[model samples]
Target: MNLKNKIVTVIGLGNSGVNAANLLSDAGAVVRATDSQDTPATREAQAALEKRNIKVEIGGHTENFIKGSRLIVVSPGVKESSVALQWAKEHHITIISELELGFRFSKGRIIAVTGTNGKSTVTTLIGEILKSGGKDTVVCGNIGNSLCQEIARIKDDTWVVIEVSSFQLERIEKFRPEIALILNITDDHMDRYNNFNDYFSVKSKIFRNQTADDILILNYDAPYLRDLKKKTRSNVIFYSKKEGSSDAYVKDGWVTCVSEGKIRRIARISDIRLKGAHNLENVLASAIAGLRAGVREDSIGRTVKNFIGLEHRFETVDTIDGVEYVDDSKGTTVDSTCRALESCDRPVILIAGGRDKLSDYTVIRGILRERVRQVILIGEAKERIRSSLDGTVESIFADTMPQAVELAGRFAKGGEIVLLSPMCSSFDMFRDYKHRGEVFKEAVKKLKTRRVPI
Candidate 1:
């Protein structure tokens, strides 16, 4: 990773890309960053990096900016089909993700979490558990902070809990974590990958370099991930809601670990604050990682008890006129939205649809029919979603998030749930899932006193 005045090209100029360029420049590399976007944000990023003497290309990438001497580092948002990557491949230049670059310089053992869903929750939980157990910890990566941004804070004793994504895993070369947890792999990011198998293969690369000493925690319910045990040399551990079938599992309302015929209780199911089976799975995975990292059962239990779930993922905004409005804007894939629905306690007036991820909307038809009282669709995927799920339930469309929320208010009645669980990415109508969730909350707030009979 010694750049030492060697030219390094950074493709994409988002937060991670900017951090990568800064990291390379600080490591004494001559860094040049490029992004096709020329927005105000990119210009601001460009201004900040230019002070560090890092060359930045904003409007578009040209051959002059890309024909480099040493290596290429890419941000997760950039496509592998881009001309810059094509050139890198054509010239046989070495390529790696910013995650890989960060790992090359990082000290301490890492706990990396990757899956179609629940990565952020599990990563945060593991970090909390380790810290509570008297271990130095820093949580970074796809849970809003890039590893390069936290390099100065990472120490040799630091337990690095990273929330990794399929995009980040695609270009990793030697980024191996001591504890690698795959929560679950469902069809996701279909827009980026050729198929589900391609996405699955890329995610499996997280443990590709791990030795037998490293541990790979998996979900026993995820059937597709079972074959992964045969693909890796790492020590494998599976977590399940059922008892006795996995290294870590829930038995008789308690979270327990079974190893070498030994059973150790970690936490009671009643102590957990997070709802839903998906979240319970997240807790089980985090507990195993914590115990493996030397966390005591009491410490793990306390952390799990106090750990509230992440925002924009099944967060209850407010109860208006006996209707509960839940925001799950982070459920950006069909599988995630289905999990959210499966966790709901009341009949739902589901608000969904966004930038389509090319997911099969019909896969969710069964859940929609069972749990959802009505479906209010919005954003670019609304029409396609309605088409796929036409006869499953009562369906309608709205052009915006506010409009969708307003419609939900009219259709929802007492003892019913109004859940904003868009099964597609939020690029079509908002900045990100957070913004979409915020808009939905605000819309819900406006309807506190206004209620209509369904």
Candidate 2:
């Protein structure tokens, strides 16, 4: 792990890769970087790396770079099957992620949160609660800034709350956090893994290296977690929305946490700023992590009461005239979109489609038929979504975001919710969910006329 004076090659120039390269260079590592893109798309990033005096190779991975590197830090976006990766493996070079490098230099308690959904909300909320409690804290990883970027800002008392993903977890070694959390896991990122079991295995790595002294928080209701707990050696803390046999749950409107023989009632579900059953579970997880980090009960209660939800994940974009527009663009999977649809009280003109990850949209049909008033499909997955719900709802297809917004607006009544909760990846139309959400906002802004109430 002594990166000093070592020849390290960062295998991508994405955010994580840039951070890794810069951090390694700062630590006196002989850093060299490589990227696949050389067109106008990646020219700026390539220029930035060269400006930093780091050697840059673009257009393709060079064999010399792989042969010359003593260590390789692969970005999450690059799969292990890349020729450069395979070449490094054959030569016995060490390959690690930015997370592993960050973990090496970190000096405080790490509270790592991993799940298919609700991680960003939970991680941010936990950091906020801890900060309100007077703890020096930094929220980093998949949700926020890279850990290396914030290394100089951290103090000994700093509490690190990291939003971890399966891709980041895949390359980690000795990156154990003091408190590890696995929220509900469902069929997600099916494009990355060979199967559901393979994806689950990588997620379970969040607790793989922990000892008995470390705490592993899990959703007792998640069948995946239930099976993984039996395989882990760490001490477990279980939370659930279901009745009985859980460390935490809500009953008669109060959110309660029972650890050993002690019972603690944190807050009421009605008191929470974020709505939906999924968010209530998020609230519980955040409160527990904050409490374990020695955050004050009053601080936890107050933060939960005032916490505004993250953007693009059940975010209320606008309510023009009468129709309400909600941007849940972060609902990249079928389960999340199902939750978003169910969260609405009014009838929904569900805007759902994007790059299909070979995902089955049939799973959410029951909710679509009962809750969604109409379906506005867009992006590459339109036909699949249309075929899945052909007869269940009035479905329309649009090729672009603006057109989709206009079509959805035509069908949206005064009392209905216009929701952009694409149940697939946004790569077909935009950079990511954030980009998709912003474009959706722009499209909604262009609509000046309001439909008369029926």
Best by TM-score: 1
lDDT of 1 at 139: 95
Candidate 2 off by > 4 Å: 39-41, 259-261, 449-454
**Candidate 1: worst-modelled 10 consecutive residues by lDDT:** 445-454
Which lDDT tens digits does candidate 1 get at residues 243-351? 7558888888998986446688888888888999988898889888888998878888889999998899899999888889999999998999999999998999999
TM-scores across all candidates? 0.98, 0.96
What tens-digit string does per-residue lDDT give for candidate 2 at 289-356? Answer: 77777876677888999999999999987786678999999999998998888798999999989999
lDDT of 2 at 359: 73
Shift of residue 97 alpha carbon in model 2, Å: 1.2
RMSD of each: 1.8, 2.0
lDDT of each: 0.90, 0.86
